[model samples]
Target: MLPSPLAAAAPPLPPQSSDEDFFSTASTSTSSDSKPRSPPPTLPQIPIVWPEAGALTASWVADLMQAFEWASKALPPSEFPSVLPVAVFDKLVLTASKILHKEPNCVRIDENSELNSDCRVVVVGDVHGQLHDVLFLLRDAGFPADDRFFVFNGDYVDRGAWGLEVFLLLLAWKVLMPHRVFLLRGNHESKYCTSVYGFEKEVLVKYGDNGKHVYRKCLGCFEGLPLASIIAGQVYTAHGGLFRGTIITPSKRSKKKNRKVVHNPKVDSLILGSFEELAKARRSVLDPPWEGQNLIPGDILWSDPSMTPGLSPNIERGIGLLYGPDCTEEFLKKFNLKLIIRSHEGPDARDKRPDLGGMNVGYTIDHIVESGKLITLFSAPDYPQFQATEERYKNKGAYIVLEPPNFDTPMFHSFEAVTPRPKVNPYYDFEDVIDSDEELDLVSMVTDSGLQQPAV
Candidate 1:
């Protein structure tokens, strides 16, 4: 249950629906005229559970899982009911927004981030819309139990056909176990990116205006999400790799002697802003100064790491800074941290490289052995890109089960993509799919696929 203050501010609940109601045809909530209607008569209940405080019972979660699986299997995922209905999503947006408002622009966390000697945490990265995989992680991996705590490293939406399913399910679980789940912002969780990516378009096509509204509200929640998390106060976690608050040096020598390259040294590279400072870095930040803007709102959301010696512009991505092992080491020492756990890049491959995966891999650790510093965690395995037809060994994904933060040994779980995902079209380009209605779909296709630290 939420604290008294937060509970008091909760949004009004819509009238209850039966077990069969969610999958039933949606009501005309999207009548161009925005008229408020009276509440529906309360039903006895579905097999689903909606206990007090929005806390879900185990039965409810199981039902929700079955609901999503049934929906995806019933029709082509790109169709109308492939995703959650308009009214349901609309209610969810409101609830999610209220919860987000309770959180500060930058959330502060000190206690929960710390893992006791016996406690273990599961750090996840970049599910990227693999709904079946997420189900596997929860059911197969056994998450969301009262005892387990989770720190999701973002990149939750986009790239997969089931992005909405993945996101809403995670959000539902967050509401279920608010204190045990932690969500960090990823590079993809913004307006500009989602607009270009398939998330925005998918909603518009599936749920229409209500979906658009829910997408907007989701962005608001994204804006309010914390940029970085301090784990056990010893590890710093974020989506992108690293950042510097300010420039300290002006120039640097290149590989050739006397050949100077332009380099702006950071004043304090390792010091992530306190919760108050992080809270201020919100949705407004789109690109970095190097790309266009002078002030990037959250560096942790955009930055990447390099193999060289110091911090440098990430010309390849056209934004954010790239740090080398030396740079990572300095940042860790500067902040008095032992490790920097990050996502943003894929674990098996550099950029979701198809056919570049293998078994027994879920995360990549860099700088830890050489510099006692960074570990990169990419949770999406066998990232099935639309054009990826080639068969390869590197199609497995991985995650880390951290044991009490005692010298950073995490148990690894790796698996390949399950069957039942769309085969012809990539997730980002789903909107472009034209009629070949007779065309064989993944239906015949056969593809497959949260903790909290602080609010205010």
Candidate 2:
């Protein structure tokens, strides 16, 4: 059952758009039918394209740069991080929440919210709280709202030491460029995950134990973030991949029966009624009580796409359902979307075959499911947490600068791990606990179901 936080303050039902009529139809393929593409080349470790390139190209960048410097220096060469004054932290989080509140729970980016077809918008994946990589990413993208539009596909916190610095930088960008910059909810952002993964302790370290208040405030912001974003009316971007949950379908029995469908307007423009129960749920209050993994929220934040043909329960992850090509086709067709871009997994720089989604192409995990539509772009180069060592993190981090007119395929600019910090000490006894990351079943369903050549 989903958590009901708004028993007395129940939000009004969401509006249904006339365009939802497109959800049930098959969308035309925007994928390339061209020959196999060459793998993207590697980039410099510290690709400093910022201050040296002249002033940053955007307005909000200067402020973000200032905050970035403060955050970077705040951490002495020690393990413990400096604290943010409760008032200062409160102002920061509250400001971010206020901006996020303007977006729907299930946000629909209208034409005005999107850039032209031939615009280079940067798309990035999991940063797992690595602050330096984020700075590198900003330098690589030339900073948000500058010459390019940016979409951070989630996992902004957890696993690394500087999650606070990284997340605040993104929030600053969002507050500054509400339209030009977008942030999606990630698996790690949820309170349940943070308490387990590392973000909670990071907060406690940075702001003191009493700073659980800041943690709660962080949850408030996470709750407000959109689940997915549509770019240029063609791309469907989210932190995790597809979700197969309580399917809320409008009755086919009679058009009149579904005409007055009631959904939470605080949720989305699409009237998804009971589905709102799941979407609007206070996921921080799930099973396992105050700790441990729960089901519903787990899938949205944790699920992965399988190359298999049908549905399968992902017992390994213990929560999310593993989806296949048919599921991908249905989701894209349901939303009339051409591309499904997710970042829960990275690409494999070593693997040249795009169909074989693995840890080779920067662990990208791209599949030719229902055509060349779904691509995973992991952005934290030389990941600096858990057991993500220099060797394992070799798959250079990347951002897709997408444009149209001729924007049929995205161009990936990948950079090698930049002056990465050492891995965080394991919080658990590996001898006692089985490493979930090692046990992850991602890419287990690798096979060529008439694999199509990637446009990359």
Index of the highest-TM-score prediction? 1
Model 2: per-residue Cα lDDT over 1-456, one tens digit each: 112112222123233233321111211111222112111112211212223433222333443444344334434423232323456456656777887877754454445765664345778888877776676556545555433577888889876677876887687677666776788888767655566567777776666655587778888888777766777767777776765433334677775576433221111122211234445544443221111122345455666777675555544454455667777777776666678788776533223224445654343535555544787788766553555555653556667767765343677666555442433444323334333432432332111222222111
TM-score of each: 0.70, 0.68
| Candidate 2 stretches greater than 4 Å from native | 1-74, 77-84, 245-297, 346-356, 363-365, 369-371, 384-386, 390-393, 406-408, 420-456
Local distance difference test scores for all models: 0.55, 0.55
What lDDT tens digits, residue by residue, belong to model 1 across residues 186-284? 877866456645778766656664666767767776765556666666667788867544323434654445543222333344333333334444444
* True-structure lDDT of candidate 2: 0.55
In terms of TM-score, how similar is model 2 to the real structure? Answer: 0.68
